[model samples]
Target: MSEKTILVWFRNDLRIHDNEILLEAVRKADKVLPVYCFDPYYFQRTASGISKTGSFRARFLLEAVADLRKNLQGYGAELIIRTGNPAEILPQLAEQYQVNEVYHHREVAYEETEISEQVETALWKLRLNLKHFIGHTLYHKEDLPFPIKDIPDSFAVFKKKVERDSNVRPCVPTPEHIVTPEITDAGELPTLSQLGLDEIVDDPRATNYFQGGETAALVQLHKYFSQDDVAVKSKSSRNSGSNNSSKLSPWLAVGCISPRQVYWEIFKHNQDGNNQNASLLKLELLWRDYFRFMFKKHGQKFIKAKTAEDEAPVLAVNELDFNKWAHGETGVPFIDACMHELNATGYICNQCRQIVATYLVHDLKADWTRGAAYFEEKLIDYSPASNWGNWAFIAGVNDAKESKYAIAAMQPKDMVSDFVTTWQPSPIDEAGDLMHV
Candidate 1:
């Protein structure tokens, strides 16, 4: 009898370590095939008229996929790379390779869920089983204190309950060896130009230059916790306007590093002393989990409005103002600096994200959806749940109302002036008048 061939589809969950889908496939099948698809839809222009995947993120993804392929090779397996819709490519691969099963991490966001469903349907017609595992969150869905639908709308309530009740599962052990059926034609990875994106210039002023992959992720985790004492410094650094937060989101967003792995590391570090840091780290992870569960419960509606009773106030879409904001040309010095940093590096610290987001929604009175879409395009760490959820929260479209007044009350003129004097000179507006706040 021929060996049972199983195909492991790689999505955002790119890492090999603690990968439930990959682990399960290896256990159940005589041979496992690892594959990644660069869906063209993601590279295409979004509704906001920006490429859904910009150069920085595109380059990061390419690096991640390359690393994944290299790691798989070490295990005597190959990662097949393809460019197209997964729905079309996966089913064809199943037929061609006589794959008995397909395994993947489940996605909660609307578009990703739709694509998964399409692929499942196509596989069903071919008599192949499509299996999904929960690899994205720190706590498994089954282990949650409440059913996802019953999850509290208030993050505080939800966090209190989960922190008190939920347990963080240990990381899944990495497999020593992966057996694979003979395969030829391992496709080449795509370049940024091929993906219709221009090359990204490195920004020296950026807080961190992100390299994508499990190896890089693990190295970062060690450096932050061991050498940097991230826990002790994060709070002070944040208050002092130093970007010292654990810059782990990019790796976390892409599943290059599992949230559980991060949780355990923090847990181990806190076992000796300073439980405060561990608590803070876990709190952040819970927030990520909350967004994912919220998305799963609410679906597309999660991004639309906070509640049915609360109607979204009609806001005029200002194209010129939005363009200025997106390009970091807004004359408000601090806001402009943050936007310019984001545009250049595909990253900004959490505080700056809130500052710019509030500016876009409250000050500029532009549609929050436009800002969210732009972040989706530009952020190297873009997770649909976290990105949209944070945007909606700032836009006052979530259960919690962020204080727009408080954000607006902040004095940015001084900060911008200081930044300009210390750093690069501010971009000049040809007109004598600075752009209005």
Candidate 2:
């Protein structure tokens, strides 16, 4: 009798802890073969002509993959790495290993879902099953108070309902030991240059302090919640020069950390006394869940801006101006400083993201997709559902109250004079045009 072999396909969810798919795989299979693919499509150039995976994100992912490989080895399993389409590589691996079935976490976004579908179809052709588990969001799909299609268009309403009715289940424990089939030659991880990205220099002004992987993610979570009262100070300190927003998004985005883990930690911390800070953090987690559910419900249509005819009127974008915005040369000093920060680093604070996005959509009048695509390329913490869904919400595509044409009402001189003086010392005229002082 042959041992039953299963393939564990690692996608965005890279961690071994509280990983439902990996847990089930180990429980059922006599032997497991773990695999990760650097999908070429993800590294290809976007329609906007920038490399879809920028150097900052590329380097982080490389670090994450390396860490994942190490962790799997600790469990006596090896992660076989490959570079190509997952739809193709997975099936070939299945054939080579004679895998009885495949297991992985499901993705909500259209492109990711499509790739999963392709792999499933390929596996079916080989008479093998491809199993998917929900692990991305704080709430599992089955545990939602309402069906995904019935989720409230308003985030506030959705949050209220979920808080009233639902609870986050406890995290699955990490496996003490994982069994592996007889296999050798666990392949080497790729470099940033190999992934078609240029080497990135560390930015002195970057506010982000994240390194990728499950181990790093755990260290950051403990440091943020247990070491100090960082939570109590978050709301007051956010958006100011002395900002202290919890910089947990990068790990969350990559599934290096699970939302349930974060939720429980904060919940436990609040037991000491009344802590509105825990409520605020949990609210942010709900918002993350809301966007993911919205993606599951609406699919690609969720990415569009709301227009009267279901088609947005094409705006005459000034390519030169858009380029300036992309490269941090926008003469509006505050906006320029934010853009420069984003370009040099892979991140900007949440407040800066909104300000720059509003400036581009309402001030520059460029299509919102352009800004979203650029962010996709740059952000190390990019989640397709959160990134595109937030863009749509900002662009009035989501069921939020529409934004007024108030860009003209904002006086650049009054709002950003001090910030500009510190971060961008160049003189600007009343209209925010660069001028010789």
Q: What is the lDDT for 60 in model 2?
A: 82
In order, the Cα lDDT scores of the candidates are 0.79, 0.77
Pairs in clash, predicted candidate 2: 306-397
* Candidate 2 structure lDDT: 0.77
Query: Per-residue lDDT tens digits of candidate 2, residues 128-215?
Result: 9998889988888898888888998777788779888888999998998988877766778888888888988886655455688989
In candidate 2, where is summed lDDT lowest over 10 consecutive residues? Answer: 428-437
Residue clash pairs of candidate 1: none
TM-score of each: 0.91, 0.91
Report the C-alpha lDDT of model 1 over 1-437, residue by residue, as the tens digit. 88888999999988989998888888888999899999998999865568998898899899999999999999999999999999999999888888999999999998899999999999999988889889899889998899988988777888779878988888998999998877888899998988888987787765568898998989988876773365364544323433235678888888899988988898877776565545666667877888898899888787676466786675796688889888877778778877787788887666567777878887787888888889888888888888888787777776643332244345456356655422232222111010000
CA RMSD, predictions in order:
5.5, 5.6
Off by over 4 Å in 1: 230-243, 272-275, 306-309, 401-417, 421-437
Q: How far is candidate 1 from the true structure (C-alpha RMSD, Å)?
A: 5.5
Candidate with best lDDT: 1
